[model samples]
Target: MCNDSKIHGFLEKLPKCEHHVHLEGCLTPELMFTLAARNGIKLPDPETRPEFSSAESLYTRYENFTSLDDFLSYYFIGMSVLKQQDDYEALAWEYFQKANADGVHHAEVFFDPQEHINRGVLYDTVVSGFTAGCRRAEKEYGMTTKLILCFVKHLPASDASKVFDLAVERGDFDSGVVHGIGASSSEVGPPKDMFKEIYATAHSKGIQRTAHAGEEGDPSYISAALDAYKSQRIDHGIRLIDSPSLMERIVKDEILLTVCPVSNVKLRCFDHISQVPIRRFLDAGVKFSINSDDPAYFGGFILHNYCAVQEAFGLSIADWRLIALNSIEGSWIEQERKLELLKLVDEHIDKHLAD
Candidate 1:
């Protein structure tokens, strides 16, 4: 989407912080097939599920997602290949490698613990693998990383709480192995406040909170998440633009909306990238970050989302700077890392402007 070479380079070099990406969502078709064979997992037959016939076929199917649920059906099947600690580590490390190349300086990635646990995978297996991937990013790229363990909302709140309690018992929050807690999946039917107990526990424990809100639902979902769950940040908060009052409240709170441009388009949330309200958010002074919610499934990574935003709205350098800075500020990082990323944003802008 970024046809202009100058702007493309500028977007590429700007340090980014990804706040909405799902580690499970990062499993590409190639890797999924590889993992399936390695783990002795048998995929559905092509006669029954033609999309799984080949990795290329699945890639083609991903190009036309009918709805969030449609994509999710395939999403769950894809992650079934991830059974071992190494599988999870590979999945996350692959994502980190792609993110690092996209100039992501800090990443707060989401992992669905309830889903894995439901499939009989150990919680330790999932967390340890992802943490290993995060560690690799730190060692090789010197990048800062944090993990957000997301609870699946479609399951009973009790299910989510069980996983949340397990995470707490493991000291995931206190030790920073898991920096936060969040809710995700099937956003429409499940009210955002369904996990009130879990979010309350998280808030009580000083763990950061965020949730998937207003993606497939209305602005009320976003408001409920903020008022009920006390979410510190919002994932896929695109619909908040429709509710001026909610938008104002989010602005007042300095909460960040992790907007995934390409995912919205690919998920059939919008017909095209131009309709995503990137420009509207900018004009309204909404603090938002462009991200890749699920790069493998959504057809693009963080930089691609940035390019799509740039192409859709033709944002100015200052607009880009504001986005990058807001992402840095919204990150669940130590104050020192936040300042470091902030400075990098300014220096990047200055150096590019001078050039």
Candidate 2:
């Protein structure tokens, strides 16, 4: 295990790629209040909504979540503050700034379209604003980004299909900002099979597929996501450790599991970060990468997540390097770009070690 200072320095310099962050979930309370005032939206009463009393207060409330459902209730409440195109743009830009500062060169972020669209926010507005932010981040910070539109499981599959069609219709899918489609929200009863047709539609259109499974659900959910939905990646797939056969299939198939340790602990998936099954994945030779699923709510960004996991598990520099490599390899970017990023990682590590 590296010392705390070494780990901090190494993580700060590491070229990271986050694959599981939610764009909406990145809304910090400061930004939430800023946007709420700018949009003329009234926040809930502080007496009743003590979480909104202050940024720190809200964070404390987020920490008290008992389950995924409990956290998501507040997650949607925070998202309600977003109204216009500028709000979405600011949200994406804010997250990109944080990611860039954390040495994240590339990111594949998730956005819930149905959540906004159902609230009368136009699909085009969200895409246009978010893509504009992506452009700015590239120009300003050299941080490349791709937006993955996620379908909320609580909504009907038909609603998801409509959003997919709307994306295609508005040329968002073809605009290069939107690269993939996936599912999010409560993974309890809405099985992957429910969105099989939607996945098929996205596949036909050459869009990559992924889903949130096996975090709050069973290992069978992971299998269904892989076999039935044909997902190219699995988000929050920690529960796969429960089934050796399923774990073997994941290893043999080379499926990428985007494990978010901080979010898992915050949502009560595990009582503590030390209990997270990252070491299990490493021992089993299962391919996985660490990410901050919802940095704002989970009390850390990607870098904090890395540091926390390193300290908890006493991960060596080599282990951290492997996780970085897995993130780049498992990303939805082109092969040429992936190669270039991997080369950068090697160069960074060599320079750090020499020093």
Candidate 3:
């Protein structure tokens, strides 16, 4: 681990933006209990406890997963307590409070409306709660946020299309606060091409696009997502480096890679944090950003993500600054807002170094 206090200081002060986190995944155990008690929900006993319940243990006990399904099984349980608009509002508020505490200036959070809607929760109710919390965060905490409605790849493409239509009908895209469509969930089913029509519909309505790819699959999936979904960014694209041609393509296209390090360790993607290819990705000049994919389930927020990468990679102050720049480059914010953020990042870095 690195002992460079100077670099650590820079990392903590660097203005940051997150682009790959899930709202449901932000449910901390303390919040989980609060929501459960209020909603009259019950979690399984320890004998049948999901592995992700160990999330409360800082993910120290989740080392036995043999497959993504095993990881997701526990992941599903972690989000089961949410049942109403108040539940969603509390989840969003809690997540932003943590993000604000971590110095996150802007964030693009993913939401799975189907997770609630399939269980009979109203679509308007889901958006109302989330948007209310985000509005409150901006007014109260000074955090800027954007929402992305993500399609569950494990479900049929038709179902995703239906939800996409619902999102548009609800004026999610018209509001500018909800700006994009994303494909997430298990990557094993429903080829990326299956959602081409949905992406097209979203595009026609002026929504931007992104997709999850290359984390647990081959680089070809990344290609399909880009080609079919017309994605502007790739989430968890760590596997792209495995194929030099694909890596070259990513750089040439300027596609941003959103990386979540501690989550990778907890999910057993690599045996050690130092094995993460963050430096390698940077050296290759592939545009990328850092994020805590699921802070609650993975046991860290954006600051922890930065600190973990810094300690594992032994990044220098310059390296930390480069990462902050990459985050600005990858953000979907308007040019005026992005410039404002860049100025803030620069000012923060300068002030910290001078201190």
Query: Over 4 Å off in model 2, which ranges?
Result: 1-3
Better of 1 and 2 by lDDT: 1
* Global lDDT scores for all candidate models: 0.90, 0.88, 0.81
RMSD of 3: 2.2
Candidate 2: C-alpha RMSD after superposition = 1.6
Clashing pairs in 1: none
- What's each prediction's TM-score? 0.98, 0.96, 0.93
Ten consecutive residues with minimal summed lDDT in candidate 2? 1-10
Q: Residue by residue across 166-261, what tens digits does model 2's lDDT show?
A: 888877778776899889999887765888988887878888999999999999899899988889999999999789999999999999999999
Ranking by TM-score: 1, 2, 3
In the predicted model 3, the residue pairs found to clash are none
Give the number of the best model, judged by lDDT.
1
**Tens-digit lDDT track of model 1 for 1-355:** 4899999999998999999999989999999999999989998998988988898899999998998989888888899999999999999999999999999999999999888898899999999999999999999999999999898877888888888888889888889999998888898887669999888878888889999999989999998889899998889899987899988998888889989989998988899999998988888888998889889998889999999888888899988888888888888888998988889889999999999
Question: Residue 61, candidate 2: how far off, in angstroms?
Answer: 1.0
Ranking by lDDT: 1, 2, 3
State the lDDT at 179 in candidate 2: 90
Off by over 4 Å in 3: 1-5, 45-47, 50-66
